[model samples]
Every structure is written in C-alpha cells, then in structure tokens.
Target chain A: MFENLLTWLDSPQTLQAIVVTGSLLLFGIGFYGLLAYTRIIKILISLSIMESALFVFFLGLASDPHKTAPILGDLFKNFEKMNDPVPQAAILTAIVISLATMSLGISFAIEYYKRTGKNDIAQMDALGEKR
Target chain B: MTGFITLFTLLSMSVVALFSLRQSNLTQSVVLFSGVGLGSVVLFFIFNAPDVALTEAVIGSGITAVVLLIGIRHMHKEPEIEEVMMENRRGIRRIAIALLVLLTLLLLGKTLLGALSVETSNAGQALLEHAMQAGAANAVTSVVTYFRGFDTLGEVAVLFLAATGVGLLLTVEKGEDAIYIEPNFILRIGSGFLFPLILLFGLYIIVHGHLSPGGGFQGGVVIAAAFLLLFLTRRRFGLSHKIVTILESGAGMAYVLLGLTGLWLMGLFLGNFLPHPAEKIGMLVSGGIIPIIYILIGIKVGSEISYVVEKLIKRSHDV
Candidate 1:
C-alpha cells in the first residue's frame, strides 16, 4: 500500500492534480484579494492573477506524459506523439487577449485615478444621484 | 524530474502571488507580479508549449512589467490604505468562503480527472494530422495561423481596440507638471549597441516561426521591447505617431488582404494558396501564407504595443 501510494505520488496524474489544485488555489487567492482590496490597481493585479491561474489550468489540462511539443522537430519524428496544438493555440490567443484586457483595465483605473485622486473602490462614488 | 520542476514552479508562483498581494507597496506588488509571469512562462515551457512560453515570457514578464511599472510611476508612491479587515469576516462569511473553496476544488478535481480519461479532442487530432500539409514544422503555428486564422484576425482587432482605448485614456489632458528623467550613460550606450541586434533577433523569430516555436506575436513583442529599451535610454527619442499608425494599420490591412487573397485563390479564407512542395517543410520559405500572416502579425503587434508603451511614457513627460 505504501508503494502504491508512492507510485501514485510520482505519477503524471498526481502532477496534474497538483497543478489543477494549485492553480485553483491561486484563483481563490486572487478572488480573496478582490474582496479584500480597495485599491483599483490591486484589484487589476488580482484580475491579472486570476487570468494567469486560468491559463495554468488550461495548459495543465492539455498536458500528457507521452506526448512531446507540437513541433515536427528532428527529435519528435512521429506526429502522433505530439502534444495537443489546440490548447497551445487557444492559449496564445488567450494570452494576447488578456493582455489587451489588462491594459484596458489599467488605463481605466488610471483614468479614474486622474479624475478623482481616489484609487479605492469603496471610496469611489462618481455616479452619485446628484448631477 | 519534470513533475518536481512543475511542482516547484507552481509552489513558488503561489508564494510569490501571496506575497505580491500581502505587500502594500504598489512597486513591490508590480515586481512580484513579474515573478508570477516568469513562473507562468516556466510552466508553459515545462508543459511542452514552447511557442506559448516565448509569448508569455516576452509579453507577460517583459512588456507587461514595463507597462505596469509605468502606470505605477505615473501615480504617487503611496501604498494603498485598506479599510476592510480580515477580522471582519466572522463566522458566517468565513464558513461560506471555506465551503465555496471546497466546492470549487471538488468540481475542478472531477472535471480534470474526467478530461484526463478522454482522448485529445478530434479537432486537435485533425490539426496534428494535417499539419504536414500546411508545410509547417510547428504544429502550433499551423493551428494558429492556418487552422484558426479567423480567431487570429479577431485577436488583432482586439489589440487594435486596446491601443485605441489606451490612447484615449492617456490623452485625456496634458500631463500637468510632468517631469522626465534622462537615462544613465551605461544604459544609453548599452541600448544603442544592442538595439540593432535585438531587432535582428526579433525578425529572425518572426520569419523562422513556421519552422520553430515562435511566430508573429512573440517576435513583434521582442521588437517592441527593443524600442522600449530605446525609449528608456534616450529622452529625446520619440515614436512618431504618424509612422507608427501607418505601420500598424498597414500590417493589419496586409493581413486582411492576404486572407482575402487566399479566399480568392482557394475556396476558404486563409487557405494554403501558395504552392507547397513536399520538400519545403522545414525551410524558411515554406508554410505558404502562414509565414506571411505571421510577419504581418509580428509587425502589427510590435507597432501597436510599442505605440501603447510610447503613449504611456510620453504622458509622464508631458508639460
């Protein structure tokens, strides 16, 4: 039973479990920060962390022990042994899109900072009932 | 060994993330954020996605750090003051958060385990099988440029929108009493010497993308990094908005036209319209319109990102 547990600990499935759980934990950390932090920049930073966690999870989901990089390099002769290109491709798009979103968010945050010297969400009441 | 490395990287990533949040200093938080980006790049590399690794390394750590730092510098150095206390989360809220976390972990574990039991998706398998026909050695490149070209087009549009939005935000009013600092002598001299070489390397990555693990976006970001280096070192150096817009929009137009050309020649948009000799698989000139689109992507991304960086930097120097 100890040997079985050790083998399981060393297995790729165990690695996958670690990655998934760790990434989800990272996401949870970001969510907690989102709830706790009032600074707009901190909130944006938390958002970026959440995005990174999601990326990690997607990459982890696509990982396989038997497969290699999806490149037809000399070392990887067989196409069948290649890793899934879809997730990598999708991730490339996601990374770029997320960068865009983050930059836009940062810009909005800075703009808000500029208009009112407050970066705290709790303190911001820009759209009040008064005109 | 790979498992151990993955575990270590993720562990460090989590630690850094926790520290980044715990710190009240905005600059330190931004620096730790770069650590998170570095960890992700390592994670991508370990996961056998070299192309994504390169992109993440270049954009995530390189450009993203600089952009975030610029934003931080634009504002005062005051650490954020938090009114909410952890002590405020009494019995009910703490229990709710704990339950939510447990449910999330359970759901994630079940879903990932189920996914692991299945084979790769059919579309992914199909792309891998037909990758050779695209005359590309990198299956990711083929998937990105040819198989899902429309998605790439949309990504470019999104980037365009981001640039526009950043421009609008940064240009709201003239930066009042903004001051610019001149870079040190060593940085100026080093950047001057390394500028051309970095530019050359970026181009090599863009052109060799079809044959290797890089493509347009990664290469373009490298080029933008080079420009950013120049911007940092030289106070007088300024990106001409006219030229940048022309190059950026021109690359976008070229990408669309190339896709339209493929559609005109072949039945589908972004099809392999150029002749693909079997022997040209790993050559620089191989991959038909894939390399072409990649070059365009590299140029467009490079121009737009650099323009964004320039706008952010110039806003700091505005009188």
Candidate 2:
C-alpha cells in the first residue's frame, strides 16, 4: 500500500488531479460567497474568485511535467519539449479582460452606492414598489 | 519535489480563498483576496507559464487589489455596519444552498477529470510547431501577437470600453466633493525615488517581450502601477486627461494601422512582414513587427488603465 501511494505521488497526473480538485473547491467557495453575500463588492470578489479558479484549472491542465516553458532561450534551445503556449496566451488575455470587467463592475457599484446611499444588493429596491 | 510544492500552494490558496470570503472586514477581505492572487502566481510559475505568471503578478495580484481598495475608499463606511448585521442573520437556507453547490461542483469536477485526457490538443501541438515562424522566442508572445492577434485587438477594445464606462459612471462634477487623503511623508519620498525605476522596469518588460516572459499586458500594468503610486503618494498630482486620451487613442490606432500594413503587404492581417531571419531568433531585435506590436499594446494598455485609475480616484476631474 505504501509503494502504491509512492508511485501515485511520483506520477505527473497527481499534480493535475490536485489542481483539478483544488480549483473546483475554490469555485465552490466562490459560489457560496456569491449566494451568501449581499454586498456588491463581495459579489464582485466572488466573481473574480470564480474566474481565477477557471484560469488556474485551464493552465494547470494544459501544463506538462516533462516539458519546459515555451520560450526558446539559452537553456531551452527549441520548442521540442515545451508546454503548450496557446492556453497561456489565452489565459493572459482572459486575465486582462477580467480585470477590465471587475473594475467596471466596481465603478458601477460605486456610482450606485453614491446615489442610493446603500452598498448591499438586497437593499437595491429603487425601482420596486415604495415601502 | 515540484508536486509537493504545487500541492502545498493549492492547499494554501484554498484556505486563503475561504478566509477572504469569510472575513467580515472589507479591507481584510481585500488583502486576503490578493493573497489568493499571490498563490496563483506561484502555481502559474510551477506550471511552466512564466508569461502568464508575470501578468497575474502585475495585473491580478497588484493592480486588482489596488483597484478594489480604492473602490472601497470611494464608498461611505457606515454601510459596512449593516453588512455585519446581515452576516449574523444568515439563515440555514444559505448554508443548505452552499452545500448543494459544493456537492454539485465536486461531481462535475470528478466527471471532468475522468473525461479530459492529460495531453495537449492537436491544435496546440500545431501552434507550437509553427510558433517559431512568428520570429519571437517566447511562443506564448508569438501566439498572442502574431497568430491570435485579432483576439488581442478585440481585447484592447473591451478594455477601452470598460475604461470609458468607468469614466462615464464616475465622472464627478465640479461642485462634487472629491476623495482626498493626506499624503504620507515616507510614501511621498519613497514613490519619488521609485517612480523612474518602475517605469524603466515596465519598459524593459515590454521591450524584451519577444525574447522573454513578459509582454504588453504585463508591462502595461506595471506602468499603470507607477502612476498609481503617484496618485497614492502625491497630493495634488493628476494626469492630464486630454494627454492620456490622446496617447491611448494614438497607440490603439497605430496598432490597427500596423495590422493594416501587414494585410496590405502580405495579404494577411498582422502578418510578419519585416525581415526576421531564423538565425537571428532569440535576439532582442529579432522579432520584427512582434516587438513593435507589443510596445504599442503596452502603451495603449498603460494609458487606458491609468485613465481608468484616475477616473476611479476622481483626481483628473479637478485637473
């Protein structure tokens, strides 16, 4: 049993499995936050957490233990044994785009708070029937 | 050895994410959220994605946390007391919902891990094979600027729209009160000493993008960070909105014009038209149009984010 566990730990797939489980748990945490929190900032934070989980999952899965980074340098002469560059590039774009959206959401929340004097989403009843 | 490190980082990240969400204090939560970003940076490095790691360190960990804290500063502090009260009154239904979500996610993750093979796709392999033809040493940079250039253009457009939206939403009239905090003497002196170095480092990252790990987006965020430091440290300092707008617009137009030039010259949008001799690969000046495009992107992203930051802080309105 100990030998079996050792073999499992040595395999590259072990890292991938850990990443998958961890990111899923992180996503769940974000989901819980989104459902439990009423503040706009908290919701935004939850959304960003969800996004980060997805980014981690994507990059972690695409990575290979045997290969080096895709940059051809003095040490790495070519792309023969390099991790996939496409996902990294795509995730890079996604990170910037997510930052843009997060900031935009924050700006909207700030404006809403300034106008309504309320920061909680549950309290945003400006269009509802008067109490 | 790497496996153990990865396991530890992931575990810590999970803990940090949980704590950040559970924390009642808004400021503490924001700081803990940045800790999560820090953990991801380490994970990205371990995963052999140095480019993505750099970008995350700059934009995800650094700028996003700053933006969140500034956003918190913009709001009145009294609402948080009500938030704390709401936290206490959370019903059992919320816990039940959270448990349900957790169970569903676990099931989904299990199925996903089983179905997805641990290998690169055929498309990715093909990109890797031809990535060198773009004349950049960093395959990710080549893929981002040369192969998937159109998507990046659209991304820049999205950032522009977001920045414009923030500006519109947060535009303070002349009579409106602006946020002003007394500058710390230490921070003021330190930022003055650090500003030029940060700008220089941002330029190095942007310029060396084709030969190294960083590129326009990461370098751009670093540049904006320098401006952020100025905003935080210096009391009456504000960016000239007109100048920033001009710089952003000009850089964006130049990017498109470069693409048009590629199309006109080689019949492919963003095609590498300049001479990029294969022997010269890995050299700083070897990537021809790739480095130029990255430089333009760096400028555009830097100016756009700076503009957004200025709008968020309401400092430019006075200027």
lDDT of each: 0.80, 0.84
lDDT per residue for candidate 1 within B268-306, as digits (tens), equals 898788987657787778878888899999999989888
Among all candidates shown, the one with the greatest DockQ: 2
What C-alpha lDDT, on a 0 to 100 scale, does residue A131 get in candidate 1? 16
| Per-residue lDDT of A39 in model 1 | 74
Tens-digit per-residue lDDT, B44-90, candidate 2: 99899999999999988989998898888877555635654355447
- C-alpha lDDT (0 to 100) for residue A28 of candidate 2: 78
TM per candidate: 0.91, 0.93
Kindly report the docking quality category of candidate 2. medium
Question: What's model 2's lDDT at A24?
Answer: 78
RMSD of each: 3.0, 2.6
Reference-based lDDT, residue A112, model 1: 75
Give the chain A TM-score for each candidate: 0.87, 0.90
TM-score for the A chain of candidate 1: 0.87
For every model shown, the clashing-pair count is 0, 0
Deviating ranges (above 4 Å) for candidate 2: A1-7, A129-131, B84-121, B175-177, B315-318
Q: List DockQ, one per candidate, in order.
A: 0.53, 0.59
